[model samples]
Target: MSMADRIKTKLTERFHPLLLEVIDDSHRHHGHAGWQEGGETHFRVRIATRDFDGLSRVAQHRAVMSELDDELKERVHALNIEVIPADKA
Candidate 1:
């Protein structure tokens, strides 16, 4: 499966987020370092879930990084994440 699909599936299974958007921004970074020919190196994830409501910003990012550890190490080169609370979404 694609990297985005993997991210969506993993996050959905783990958090049951109220909203999740996995955007592949690799195309925009073409020719930059770690930009592969077929893309899938950079991503932007917008996630809103009650699970993150009480966490600090760093904790929230860590939680997500933990979930996507394999992707980060294996394929994705850059990840920009926006973690929002369900109430705000």
Candidate 2:
């Protein structure tokens, strides 16, 4: 699967998100540091999941970060995540 697809799948499997939106924002960061020819360096993820129901914003982000693990350190240079509870959708 593609990098974006992989990212989406990983998040879905790990968090079972009720809503997930993975946006490739590499084009917006063109010419900036860490920008590459391919559009995989920057991403924005909007996810709503039961796992985030009782978590604070920082905790929600931390959960995602842990799920992303090495992908965040390697392929993903910039990531913006908007995490919310499933009911908030």
Candidate 2: residue 19 lDDT (0-100): 91
Q: Which one is best on TM-score?
A: 1
lDDT tens digits, residues 12-80, model 1?
A: 999899999999999999999999989999999999999988899999999999999999999999999
Candidate 2: worst-modelled 10 consecutive residues by lDDT: 80-89
Off by over 4 Å in 1: none
Model 2, runs deviating above 4 Å: none
Q: Please write out the lDDT profile of model 2 over residues 1-89, one tens digit for every residue.
A: 66688789999999888899999999999999878898798999999999787788999998888888878787888889987668887
The TM-score, computed over Cα atoms with residue i paired to residue i, of candidate 2 is: 0.93
- Specify the highest-lDDT model's number: 1
Instruction: State TM-scores per candidate.
Output: 0.97, 0.93
